[model samples]
Target: MSENKTSIRKKHMEFTPMVPETTFQYADLSIKHIDAENTLAMVRRAIRMGYDAVAINIDLGDISDYYTELDMLWTPGSQNNVDGEPPKKKKKKQQRKDELADGIAGILKKKLIPPPHYVDVSQLNTSELEKRGKVFRQFSRITFTANEQVVINKVFIHPTILSYDIVAVRPGEPSVLDTLSRKTELFDIITIDHLEEERRKWLSVSKVMDRIRNDGVFYEIAYAESLMPATRKNTLFNGRVLIRSLKSKNIIFSSGAETMLDLRSPVDVMNMSLLWGVANNEARKMISGFPKNLLLQAECRGTGNGDVCSMKLSDAEKLAGNGEEEEQDGASEEKVVVGKEEEAEKVKAPPIEVRMNHSQYQALLQATKNANDMMKKIKASKAASSS
Candidate 1:
């Protein structure tokens, strides 16, 4: 098997093989056929692709369908159980003994089975992932095919939807697009999931672009779609038009891969951006800075307030050192102040003297002379009147 591009880089770079912190992978982990083991494998492949972070996306629209299927499986007299009754006691005891024997056999075989699909990220301890400095963020995205004016309210208030780290909206119709173009706190991303023509037509209006920009919402281009032969042409064309419309201001590039094969490296993504009309600098940011800012904004929303500090370990360490220094300096200053208070009996301030410059003195003299001259004129008038 060929070594991963990341491992190749490590060989050349001669180091512990660190992926750039800006590299992120946004992929679908909730697909119908993707089990937990498959999802973990996809994440591992992403890590090999040099992604420092991965966002597991759950589509809000698809979740209901999934649960609905699950419900159908539990129907009365379903194949899953015999009328929902407990297994026979004799069979249960025999099955338990057989399972114990199978468990011993499994241990001897060194076979490890993954947890059930129902186990979400919250249920797992991520200390090992943290040790690798790898982060997994959960995002919920909903694509609106029409004006879901009625359902929009329910979607926003849904507890599971609100718990997601990020909420992205993809409007499929003009009415929905226009509604999304306005300021609303319900979404962080205005993803461009339409065809080439539709993307161009919708983004042609400057007002819509301006509103999206004003709202600080990001535009997303899912690269995995571009990798698929069927959707490649549409993806490329739509991406080019989207970059032209947004001018790479608030754009993010996500893998959107349902499987590991669809994943690409961050550098490859930037190179792909060049084909989409995004400049090299902006392209780099699409995979890095832009997505990072979007995640930060999403975090602020999830926390219900934007006023918070998310410091890196290095930054926290530096601040801790500075705080200690400040404490020492403050203690010394306090001691000095106390000593000064004890040593000094009484302190008095010298009186402040007021002085006029030559120009000011001359002006004052002129004013005094004018007053005396006026007074003398009044006295002379009075004497003349008396005479």
Candidate 2:
């Protein structure tokens, strides 16, 4: 029976790559000629090359125009003429508090561009970037830390935060000891792109694999070009290099897709994995297991089922039998349904006569009031500090 189940699972198992909604509409290859077309092509090709998932970049650079437009649209009424022109009155000295409030309000309303998913703003000294991070946090499901560069005189220091997942060094060079000393926190997954070949060189793909095995850093490597046929040869080389050097159990492949055209349908990613010499069972795990594990670590939802360890596929006939049993139980329960009015009346019924003493009730009320007062004070303090 076990052997038959394994055979059945092998026959039915299909790999599916999950693409984000924003990039779903632009998955076609023909749209590659549009502005920033190469990014899409690279992603598609990467998918064809067996990358199971893609990361979309939402950097400040890409959304600069949108930010500019929003800023113009959301400009303060006091700062503009009634006719939508700049204030023509003689300049008056503005209070620091008012100016700060206006600036913060403009940014909070999406007046500025949004940053990309992987780019962390913590390193930047700009107050605007800090504000942007806070605002974006509300809508963002993934938590990201910035990669800061520290420079003293002419020498460079390694980034402070270094872990298998979130390393301080770029892709090419070893991080300097001085910089590593300032280390703070670690991320579960650190993204490495081709642009920083220097830091990437410090740790080879094999080294990254070892870290993934020994430490639990989930590394995401991004290739610059469209990950399809044109880049297939090089991608395969890199893929083989990483796969052959590392123990197979530790590696996860993904497409670093940033734009609309960069997305690959889940079906395509599954097929591509098969072509990349990933075993059938392992390929399914790569497309499903890796992303799911990463999402859970990041405290995100709706990515995968959040099960990275294993999957069990059952026969449809067995499922049908189970469904029939459930249907019969449901049918019997449904025969005694209550209307909304009846439900409301049942809920309105008085509780059994169990009463607390006056002293106990008074104590409970006092405790609740105290808790509320404490909460209010804390909130007020936070508001005052932010202001």
Candidate 3:
């Protein structure tokens, strides 16, 4: 118990208050699946390598019959033109239709499972790693597979999709990329699958990349693809094009590993990024800073203009520790003061020995015993009266 208290105090002393934790120092934001055991092992491996977070990705095959941006103009709470007068009833007819469509979409969404969450950092004890000042956070991500231009505005607001912390779209059409690049609120990341030859054309020129960057959306590079023989050349070639276009801004590297074997450490990914002509600092930022901004952007998409924040538990924990320490210090000081006062009261003259006849000695001893008993009774009475 003493050891535990000492260790806790040491951690609290080292902590910085209100300063944001470097939670995104090394994040594997794309973990491919939600397998119970395999994902757990992969996350454990990631944590061991100092990754702060992972997003369990669930594939959204296609977003169909979603409410469009135009539809919101007629809805009760219009996303745009809030200062303008409420839309007339004639304009609201379309919103009513969209609401009916939304009902159907909600019914369809009922069959879908919400993203899985793993609250434990380790198997042994959840608090163990926290005590050691390390944290592993898990988030849910939905990667929508967009195969058409209509797919962009066609995404329905499914409850499950809204529940996810990250929204990543995999576009098969260049039009989808062009559209999503401007509408940043719709998604957080635009992921490209390097395995397909045609997917190269999906990235056209600097125009789309500029819009994406201006909007604060990140283009994710799955580093695991580089480990493949056939896809390696394409990954490098296209990656170079993206870096040239975006100038290494708003780009984040994630494992996107389907299994533990495909997983690469952040250091390894940083080294591999050199092949794309990214400098050391830029490569480091890809795993740390860019992803940090990406998560903030994602949370904003879900919360709109609201003041929602995703903060580490460590800061709040430090506050609680500070409060507890102050209380303990005050208590200890009070104990010291009380001890001194009690000692002063306990001070008394010591008994002196004197040679005497046995009878005289016995009488004196009895008298002393009676006097001690009387003193104890008087002290008890005084204590009761004081209370």
Candidate 4:
């Protein structure tokens, strides 16, 4: 029991919580699929806990019908404009027909609800609107995939900057838009795992962060705890490099947490910030102030009144040396072994043929006989052909 206690203590000392700068909250906007009351409760909890911001994910499955209905409803009035006109009983039957169509239109319009803050584009389905407008906002924001291509061609390429993920960029390759036009810029908030793979393939996180910092692109980095286990080495290394190299003012720490269950309490994230060298006030600003400001942009205020401790400097310095040496050494050794010798060994091995399961010596004998038989058959065929 005493020995077990000592072992447990040692393990505890070695354990470092894999917490990062940001946590992201993912929210589904499906009114029917999601329990509204439960969702509100979770949102309230997140608000109380001080989570940075919530990412509202609107998938195509959620709003396909809405968009289709909207398209159908707007098809009739594609060119019609209702000017103020008095009611005439002579046109009562025509008016009744118009009234019924209008009633149906109203219902369809109500049903074609877009995601919050999203502007609907299905209504402005005119060639004139398309030509005159630089970009039109899609009414059904939930149809992300179907509308993404449309957005890129009609919206992103326009003078306006659209805030959707560009699906075209592949690993180790420059963005299609990047190669095509200097004026067009691609921005995305990739997972730490994806970023790590990209970093490994081309540039380090510091290099990427530096480029973004210099380029002045508006972007956010969200920390995913679920991805942490799979991306342990890259997460720690990249995060350390990023925090060290990038200006704190440029970096936005977010909860990349997907659901309410996935979220850690704001206090927990605050504690994580402390671990990551953030002062309490600075941590509060990153978690609450920065995200609200960026998401709300002009409307949100920047002042964050939170307790900040002066001991953060000494505390960070003290914790700086924790497990770094072990991680670096382990990563280096693994990379060296994986890169060189493994492929060479595969090429050097000779191909062997065997008919059936047998003893090792029997299998060898069978393989030898098979090879000799094939050689003899080849010689016989050659002789026959010559003759």
Candidate 5:
């Protein structure tokens, strides 16, 4: 009977444990020439494929080229003014009415040019999708290609780049890579274009990987491009060099998928990592653990602290209730302290324990010794003055 049951189980689909809730897949929404609909479709597909989060990558090239005030405003119909005619100024009362009627998109289109093929996730019917048991989050990542020092400088100051959740840079040469690797505050990911032959050579350097690891930056590998027959050779070559040099240290594998057909589930992506010479445990980390870490770092970089951006109403309500209870307890305690002299007298400061590691303890001892020497000098000076 046991044998029969085992056979039945084998005949059916194999049992695979559910992917952890924290596991995420970074799908490439930045595929060149991709439209808004296609990008939104990719986001939906990622959510359906069991990914908890996706980073919509945006590439900003030659920052100087995009530095005009018009670029800043990115007004859809105002890319260039005919015969240098200035934009029309509206009456204050009328302008407010138009803005209120047109809504955010209308105002945004009037002020700034949105990124090429940028999909506004806010407009998507996410509430309906969340009902299906799949909850997903979207983040923005700006990929800067370091072609020139001037360009890099322009990108650093660019308001659009700062607005992104994650900021990444693709160094044009080895010198640029070296410069960016040490500057952790300026970059989140050192992006590599798999199709570029030059990038493979640059990525192969041991020092480059070392600096990246020390500075807490991730090495990005976009796997979706490998599926294309035209770019397959170059993609594989870059992938081999990247995996060989970095191994498992601070690597994030994302499907630079442009469309729905190119997208793969997180489990499938883990299996794909095996083909790239990644170990089983490491492969799992690429899709799950590594992405989570990258997002956490990006979150901290963006908001000054890693905070969960969204919460359920139930959770919020519970937190509110707990806060009320805490407030009540605090009030009662305060009343007791004020009303009872003995209770007020009994309230004392809690003892603080200072525990230190070897290095910290040594530093503390050195500080004490320095203070003692300074005190001795002061006492000697006092004695001399009295004499």
Candidate 6:
């Protein structure tokens, strides 16, 4: 029965994404990474449409819905320690506390059978994309709709939340935008939602520009919203205001696409930017250059002291870039030593060997005794002064 289950899961995991030849440059930071066949199809469509990099977005608002359905030991107080059961080790006790703090107790408890934190794109074949110079890549991102400052604050440093490649938010008010700006290391992109016009009213000239300047965070305007008949006006208004305020500098044009139908080519998105009050030169960067900067900055966030660590693949690559790159496999070490050192320095120093007569040996011993006495006297004097 166990063997059958394993085989069944492997079969389900097996998938081949559509691999049309493509090149890199453009990025779409918001790709819905849900557990559906259509999500894979959406990624396939993205590649075919010329997107080189994409991020799988997980919305905090819909977490409960996704978690409950996945069903991996999620219950009230599941992360809490049992009253009478003693924690065998301090490490185990601390682990439980972390689980509660991060609200990932269900995932922590299961060990090997942990709940999914991000979409698995390991099965994706990118050989064709790589061959074409695109090097297709996928990243995980978490979206938070900032309604309650307290709620967003509590989860801001959550291990699972910070683990994503990007952390984006859609602020509902001016105060929330102010709060989001200060958290440079936690949040990456500030998404604009035209569907909720009231939520976007707080977006001001000074406020938007200040957040962009101070935090160096990017503002994402979804082109998909512009295509909708009802949302087109608000989308154009919000995007143009953002473009005009930032002077076409910090804006990123994305599809915010849920399905393949919503995804558009990079050229189409860039063309739309020109109509939104940006120059043709800056228009091209709205899709490619600005987003590439955002991705690099977001990636480096995990490589710095607050959240950066060498454990992540992308983080490891950044860490490697800072210093010397690794030598090729089977390279000669002798060549490296010769290249880096003088001929005299190449040979190791010989071990010291000394010979002394009886009288000389006695004098050396007496000198050593005098030096030990001098050190002891100095230490005693320093101790006396400290007292």
Per-model TM-score on C-alpha atoms:
0.53, 0.35, 0.60, 0.36, 0.58, 0.59
Best by TM-score: 3
Candidate lDDT values, in order? 0.55, 0.37, 0.65, 0.37, 0.59, 0.63
- Top-lDDT structure, candidate number: 3
lDDT of 3 by residue, 87-144 (tens): 6854675667778678666655534444445535447233534655655567777776
Residue clash pairs of candidate 6? 302-308, 303-308, 304-308
User: Which runs of model 3 end up more than 4 angstroms from their true locations?
Assistant: 1-24, 61-114, 117-119, 122-132, 306-387
Pairs with steric clashes in candidate 3: none
Give lDDT tens digits, candidate 1, residues 71-164. 1222222223345565685466566666667755544543221112322556545565466666654333333232354435445544444544
| Positional deviation of residue 209's Cα in model 5 after best superposition, in angstroms | 2.4
- The TM-score of candidate 1 is 0.53
Q: What stretches of model 1 exceed 4 Å from their correct place?
A: 1-33, 60-147, 194-200, 302-387
- Model 5 stretches with alpha carbons more than 4 Å out: 1-33, 61-64, 68-134, 302-387
Per-residue lDDT of candidate 5, residues 1-387 (tens digit): 667534422211111223644333343323332566777777766666666567776665533344423333322332333564444633444565555557545434433313423356675555544555444566666665676654565465444555566677777777767766656766688767543775555766777778777767788777877788888778777777787887678888877676688788877888888667888888877776666776666655533433233445443333233223322223211111434445542211111233334344345434555655687799999999999
Instruction: Give the distance in Å from residue 240's predicted Cα in candidate 1 to where it truly belongs.
Output: 1.4
Higher-scoring candidate on lDDT, 3 or 6: 3
Look at candidate 6 and tell me the lDDT of residue 17.
Answer: 26
Order of all candidates by TM-score, from best down to worst?
A: 3, 6, 5, 1, 4, 2
Using alpha carbons, what is the TM-score of model 2?
0.35
